[model samples]
Target: MNIVLFEPEIPYNTGNIGRTCVATNTKLHLIEPLGFSLDQKEIKRAGLDYWPKLNYEVYKSFDDFMEKNNHPKVWMATTKAHKVYSDVTYGSDDYIMFGPESRGIPEEILVDHEEECVRIPMFEDTRSINLCNSAAIVLFEALRQNHFEGLNLSGELHKLHWND
Candidate 1:
């Protein structure tokens, strides 16, 4: 699985998402014109020691990304979409692209690929959800659909209480 962030601004959110990517064995992609530096302390602080473990890439532009990757199935997450994320089935190598914290993917791109767009179910009153949280929601759903093929899972439960 892959997570692509277009013009992400918040280092903390990016770091959290990066950590999530490492934990889930998903690849991360960041488009150019980022709001913060990758070396910023906040990113490392949020990502902790797992920063080095994250598999990611930086693209100069969206067109450059599309040119290089050319992935067969790319799902763009946006608030303007009609399809619920859970409605679609995801493949292991499918690319899931997200927009920046402030504006999301470009409207032109979204309009061009409207059919491939998805959205998380939320109350009608709310404008949107957190970027990292939204990514987790959709990414995990895909993982679940695939029975967590490459992900680690443990059947053993760590009991929080002893016999009382």
Candidate 2:
């Protein structure tokens, strides 16, 4: 599975998400107009030397990202959606998109692709979860549903764990 961040605003969050992607062996794509430079020291500090270990790519624009991957289906995570994320059938090639910290995806994009949206259930009055946390939660669920057997594994035996 791949994680696509659309115009992410905070470098620290991006760094955390990058590290999570690395740990899960997921490819991370960052769409541009980023708030900070990739070489920014804060980003590196937040990532804590795990940046080099992560598989990531930076796209100049969303269109450029779409042109390359061009997956037939994309699942956008939004609070406006009624469908819970766990209800969807996530495929291995399906790209999961998340928006920025402050503002979600642009209305034009969201409206154009309303059918593809999914949301995590939350209590009333809660705004939203952290971007990195949400990504990790959903991505791991997708991986779990797929059995997560073929994912990268180091030459070491480790105990298996699952969340919920």
Candidate 3:
């Protein structure tokens, strides 16, 4: 799976997303004009020791990203969509894109790909969910639909065994 961030402005969110991507073995694509430098301490601090292992690339633009990645199968997450994310069948290599913290993916782009857009169900009064949380929610659903391939499904306690 892949996670693409369009013009991400928050380093902490990006950092935390990066850590999640690393843990999930997912690739991350970042579009440029980023609000914070990749070298920022905040990003590193949030990513902790996992940033080094993260597979990520920065793109000059969305067009550059599409052209370079050969136009991957992407699902855009936005508040303006009819379908729920889990309704769509996700391939293992599918890309899930989220927009900037403040604005979100451009309306023009969303209009062009309306069929591929998805939204989490939320109350009409609220604005939107947090970026990192939304990503995890949709991603985990995708992972679950695919039976969480190559991921650990269980764990052991440090000093106790469940079978004891």
Candidate 4:
């Protein structure tokens, strides 16, 4: 799967998302006009040693991303969407787009792709969740739908047993 961040503003959030992408084997796409430099130290601090392992690309613009990606199926995450995120069956190669930190995706873009938009259900009191949390939530669901393909599912069991 792929995670696309449009004009992300926060360095720490991007750094956390990059770490997630590295862990999940998901490609990260960052659109231009970013608020922080790619070489920002906060990003390195958040990502730690795994920052270098992040498979990602920087795009000049949304149109540039579209042109290079060959019209891949896109799923936009937004608050105005009707469908719940988990309701849609995600594909391994589907591109999931998240808007900037401050303002969400442009209305024009979301309107044009209304059918493909989704949202994480929440109480009306909250406007939205943090970018890194949102990305992890949706991406993991997508990974779940795809049966967690290309992921390491097994690790050494803990020494203590529940039955003990």
Candidate 5:
């Protein structure tokens, strides 16, 4: 799975997302004009030991990203979408894009790709979910649909054997 953050602001959030990407073996794309530098201590701290293992790229602009990535299919994550995220059939190379923390993806962009926009179901009174959490929810669902390709299905206990 590929997770794209456009103009991400918070280093902590990006770091956490980076860790998640590493755990899932997913690629992460970060658009430029980021609020924090990748070298910031907060990023390494939040990403923990997994920071170095994260597979990610930084793009100069949206057009640069689109061109370099060959205009791959992208699913926009937004609160304004009428489509439920789980309803879409995600391909292995599809990208899930999230907007800046302050405001979401530009309304114009969402309008242009309205069909590709999707949203997570939430309480009517609630405003939104945390960026990191939202990304995890949709990403895991996509992974689940693909039967968690390239992922460890189960784990073993540290002090005891599974057969024990």
Candidate 6:
């Protein structure tokens, strides 16, 4: 699975998400005009020295990303949605896109991919979850639904046991 961040603002959140990608062996794509430089101390601090170890790609623009990836479908996480994330069947090649903290994706883009939009269930009056946390929650569910096979850590499958 892939994680795509569109115009992310917070360095620490991006750093945290980068670390998540590294740990899960997921490819991370950052769409640009980022609020801070990639080498910003705040990003490196949260991501730590292992940031370099993560498999990540930087796209100059969303158009550039679409041109290259051409993902069959993109599952966008938005609050203005009727369907829950668990309602859809996630594929291995699907691109899961998230928007900036302050503002969600533009109306044009969201409307363009309206059929693929999804939202996590939440209690009333709650705004949204943290970017990194939301990404983790969605990604793990996608992986789980796919039986958690074919992932980089699959080889260590035998090591996963339930003590309970």
TM-score for all models, in order of appearance: 0.93, 0.88, 0.95, 0.95, 0.94, 0.88
lDDT of 3 at 38: 97
Cα deviation of 90 in candidate 6 (Å)? 0.7
Q: Per-residue error at 131 for model 3, in Å? A: 0.4
Better of 2 and 3 by TM-score: 3
lDDT of 4 by residue, 1-164 (tens): 99999999999999999999999999999998899998999989988889999999999998899999997899999998999999998989999999998998999889989999999999977999999999999999999999999999989966887797
What do the candidate models score in CA lDDT, each in turn? 0.92, 0.86, 0.94, 0.94, 0.94, 0.87
lDDT of 2: 0.86
| Residue 146 lDDT (model 3) | 87
Off by over 4 Å in 3: 159-164
Model 5 lDDT per residue over 55-99, tens place: 999999988999999998999999999999999999887899999
lDDT of 4 at 58: 96
Q: How many steric overlaps are in each model, in order?
A: 0, 0, 0, 0, 0, 0
Better of 1 and 2 by lDDT: 1
Question: What RMSD, rounded to one decimal, does every model reach?
Answer: 1.9, 5.6, 2.4, 2.6, 2.5, 4.5
lDDT of 2 by residue, 53-115 (tens): 988888998789888776457789999876889998899877899999998877788887888
* lDDT string, candidate 6, 1-164, tens digits: 88999999999999999988887778898998798999999999988877999898899998899988864578989987667888899998788899998997777889888888889888999999999899999998888888776656535445656795
Candidate 6 Cα errors over 4 Å, as ranges: 150-164
Supply the TM-score for candidate 5: 0.94
- Report the CA-based lDDT of candidate 5 relative to the real structure: 0.94
